[model samples]
Target: MKLIKGTLVALTCAAMLMGCESKKKETSSIDVKDAEVSKNLVLDLSVDKVKNTLGTLKEADSFPRNITKGQKDWNLVGVRDWCSGFWPGVLWYAYELSDDPEIKAGAEKFTAPLKEIAYTPADNHDVGFMVYCSYGNGYRLTGNEEYKTVMLAAADTLATLYNPKVGTILSWPVMVDKIGYNTIIDNMMNLELLFWAAKNGGDKSLYDIADSHAQKSMEHLVRPDYSIYHVALFDEKTGEFTKGITHQGYADESMWARGQGWGIYGFALSYRETGKEEYLDTSIKLADHFIERLPEDGVPYWDFDDPKIPNAPKDASAASLVACGMLELADQVKDNALKVKYTQAAKDLMAKLESKAYFSGDTNQALLLHSTGHLPHNSEIDVPIIYADYYFMEALVRLKKLEDKIAMQ
Candidate 1:
């Protein structure tokens, strides 16, 4: 009995020591290291370029056009940024990288008008992307309840704005006798906001709607070629696919760069959430086409084969968006070769944009310049855009990962 008691005491002491050692181990929040970041290529786009751009322009209630010294064609469509769901998102990404007070201040300029967006009786599914990426992400990083209040209000607005009977979130409000556009591939990108709302709002049904639309997107929006259709019509009652088309693509027939980027990124996220092979497969297939179409410089034309239209300079912004998507794609694929190829493709595109269109010897906007947004409609025809800035920074993060892998090798 004495011997047994001694052994038990010894074991207890050893176990306590082991537990202490385990607890003593240092905890790292994130393993990502920038040491692998390519030495000659770093500009700290978050800090330097954004500081320069913001220096040139003030946060107007509206977007500034023809407003900056470098701006082309002095026309203030100012709505393009809003169309991408306005300020918070772009600034959210901005602050995440820089932790800049200026970016936070900049985010507020759009909030008042954007609050109206959440409350507006129209079905612009992008409010989540527009507002949450900024306000929600901001609150998450900082733990400020004010941002949460803004998001809650936004969710209420989105809930009111939601068309429940349609079984999908309508993107744009009805414009005079227009069929409410209940389904668009772009909404796939917007669903993240709904998922977030469900999380924060305690509304499980909100996520159900978001999930249903995503399933529909996979079912009806993707073609056999794995090229995604831009729009699909659904029966409001049944959620059945009634019809689908390519509204934003060239001639309703070709792939649009930004839309494709949305598809790849959205599908990749879906896979990340569900770990489903189909989503992963779909992401890989679309990614394959995106990679195959890259110009020698790794930047893509707005449309992959845009008929070589005369006087059409390239859309470097589109290239940047695709590059950002490819970087995410690199993370999803399990195959080593696919991972290296996608990551390298993204890095090569970044190198090209940085060297060619994105960089200026003295200018601080080192990510990209002269991007053409919606040339056919003549919107933001040729200007640097915020999404381009966001994507460019995201690519750099991925590039940093690639660099780390290279260092490890």
Candidate 2:
């Protein structure tokens, strides 16, 4: 049965543990409903919504057809690390819910190779979330040495990008003698790699470097409103923030949908790493702004402020990322009212996405509908995105705590 193979796949990375040299803490207390009945009601509603969404994904055959792609069009599972990484996370959540060894195997099968991918010569900053969030979690769940090795190696590679002078990792690759390039908002996700290194690899310097880079981004990349500027120009040798430009958005200052999502979760992560109230405060401010500006359905338009992208559809991937971040923020924040708002907003948004946007016919392709890859870059607009699917499943599992995932359509 496909279910058997699916479960077996997760075994590849099962029984791994997170290696951390330090403990990260946030002092904020979440305002989870104190009344047992009220909390249960909210939890039940969220769980029901999550189950229905997972069901839709299963019915749709949501796993991408081609895991490794040649690039005629887009394949959700383009490569092992690029898109397929989500499978491990999905499997982990599935295993959590069902206690099925098959689900566990699936997560392992997909997560086992993360080290190789991250160490590849072409690796970039997103490697943290791209590799670690999937495989690292697998290692954490299963105590698997291979996945842990990979996670550590990936963290090391990510650290190599650090520019001590500039106090941030050089984001993308550039040609020899080229200059005028810097980090992107998406790179924020990479900090987790450094964090893992500090925790598990006995590398405190890595965390220090990560902290410095994050501070640089906050100083130059994040706007006053907490909206992000995608790409910035930096002095190559000096590594100082030169200027911020809108590389992925309409212009230099426009906030991209995905970029905003990246910032919310990324900054929240920074807060998690260090209990500094400022990061938490910044995260809340951005989350509030994002929630307030969301479209009626809770999914945001491509840009919260820009009007240039023509007929921009709601990005399912952005919504999914934002939801996960919101949930994380909800659990992290101390204020009762704020926690309720963030958690409820996340749930409400996912509920709508689960109901209206998910493709329900094939288990291999279950994803919330209407994702835009990139407009200017023309990557994938209004379609399925693997990261979106990953974060969506992450949100579901985080919310509902369901675990048994069989790859049955």
Every candidate's lDDT: 0.61, 0.65
Model 1: per-residue Cα lDDT over 1-409, one tens digit each: 1122343344345445555667763211010012222233233434444555555555454543321336332233342344444334555555555566776676555544555555554455667766665666567667777667767666666655455665566666652145434567777766666667677854777767676666767888787777777777766566566666665567555777777778887887777655778878888888888777766656666666478743445666666777877787788899999988888877777766676345432342434565667667766555666566556666665576567678999
Please list the residue runs of candidate 1 whose C-alpha ends up more than 4 Å from where it truly belongs after superposition: 1-42, 64-81, 84-88, 99-113, 159-166, 179-182, 235-240, 309-311, 360-367, 401-409
| The best candidate in terms of lDDT | 2
Which residue segments of model 2 deviate by more than 4 Å?
1-81, 175-179, 306-310, 359-364, 401-409
Q: What is candidate 1's TM-score against the reference?
A: 0.76
Give the C-alpha miss distance for residue 383 in model 2, angstroms. Answer: 0.4
- Candidate 2 positional error at 52, Å: 16
- Predicted candidate 2 versus true structure: per-residue lDDT over 1-409, tens digit per residue: 2233333233222212111321342110011111121323222333233334333333122334221222322243434345555655665665654555655665665566455666775456667765776777787777888777777777777788788878888787662145465778888878877887798864789889888877888778888877778876688777667778765576777767888888888888889987777778877877887877777656776776657434566677888899988888887898889888888888877766665245322222444456776667866666666677668767867776422222232
In candidate 2, position 359 carries an lDDT of 34
